[model samples]
Target: MTRIHCLVAAVLMSLSLNLQAEGADLYPLSSPAEQERFQALTEELRCPKCQNQNIADSDAPIAKDMREEVHRMLQQGASNEQVVDALVARFGEFVRYKPQLEPRTVLLWATPVIVVIVGLLVITLVVVRSRRNTETSSALTPEQRRRAEQILKDAEAP
Candidate 1:
């Protein structure tokens, strides 16, 4: 039983070591500060190829390039803002996870609001026109009223 316990402990230790080794090769950032900055910046940036995912979370070639660029910028003593600005300059605002609020982006942001307002106005106009038509056509001609009364009397007789 003691031998079996030792074997189990050795297997657990090996598994832990293997898992650590797998991650060790992945984070190429030289220092903890650099790694943190790289992660923050990448997570904030969009991956162009995988538009739904941030750079750090994507496995695309562009994401890898972006990660490498982050490392390079960190080595050059560039601040997070500076790195992000550089990326925005090179890749445009579309590369950012959060698009900047600007005149260029006003249409993208305002289109839905404008459409909703127009839809409401259209519905209001339709309802108003229908209501007005109903009111205006409420009164029947004398001949039409007489015909309606005759039809109702026939229906009741049956």
Candidate 2:
């Protein structure tokens, strides 16, 4: 009974492994160059459904469809730019992992710099105000100077 159970488990494991191998086959490319390009594009493109994940890393249905579309376009002899343009037209700049520098995206690219500049301005204002306060408090009017000198003299006499 033990030998029979071991034989059955071995057969089941072999069958599962074969199925996985079949499923893992990549779409055929015309050449090694095309395969490299396909990989680069997939890694660079973001999945519309999985906003934070690139298509190569995402398992979302939209990502799967996008992968299929890219494979189809590459097989049909589409240039890298052409394939990217098609996707950007159908979906939007949001589908790109690195968006281009454009008027519409200026704010997105500049926000960090703008924030740093604003923070520096605030710190300068605070420092200047503090110094002004310190100087004003340290300076004495004529009457205040006389009063302080008199108090010091009285203390010395006692």
Candidate 3:
């Protein structure tokens, strides 16, 4: 009985997993160029509801509506930039998977590069400082070495 229950649960879980994939819309377009544009736009735009997913891959209602809007705009002969701009205006820049390079997003875009540069500089400074300290400390005079050895010998004496 337990084995039967496990099997039923596994089947149901698999069906639920596929439900999202099955929910994708099939929009019609006029030409291959338009079809390519539609595909590109849908795949490029992120779903507001599914933060990590694009509209083409997400099953969210908002994603479906966005996809429909993209299709309608394309059919109305809107340029790709116009369609994207309209969506961005409606949903804010969060809808764009790749944000435009502007003053507001400059810090976000530059953070990784800034971090890497700082890390490299820190490593270089540490290495150079360590080498300099080693060089200075290792330059012990012969007299100092003899005195240090005598001190060690005296310490080890009875």
The number of the candidate with the highest lDDT is: 3
1-158 per-residue lDDT for model 1 (tens digits)? 69999999999999999987875456566788777887788889988889589987788998888878877888888999899999889878878877777999999889899999999999999999999999989989999999999999999995
What is candidate 3's lDDT per residue for 1-158, written digit by digit as tens? 69999999999999987874554336767888888899899999999999689998887999989999999999999999999999999999999888999999999899999999999999999999999999999988999999999999999999
lDDT of 2 at 98: 79
Candidate that beats the other on lDDT, 2 or 3, i.e. the better one = 3
RMSD of 1: 4.5
Global lDDT scores for all candidate models: 0.86, 0.89, 0.92
Assess candidate 2 and give its TM-score to the true structure: 0.76
Error of 1 at 41 (Å): 1.7
Candidate 3, residue 48: lDDT: 93
Instruction: State every prediction's TM-score relative to the real structure.
Output: 0.73, 0.76, 0.75
Which pairs of residues collide in model 1? none
Q: What is the lDDT of residue 73 in candidate 3?
A: 98
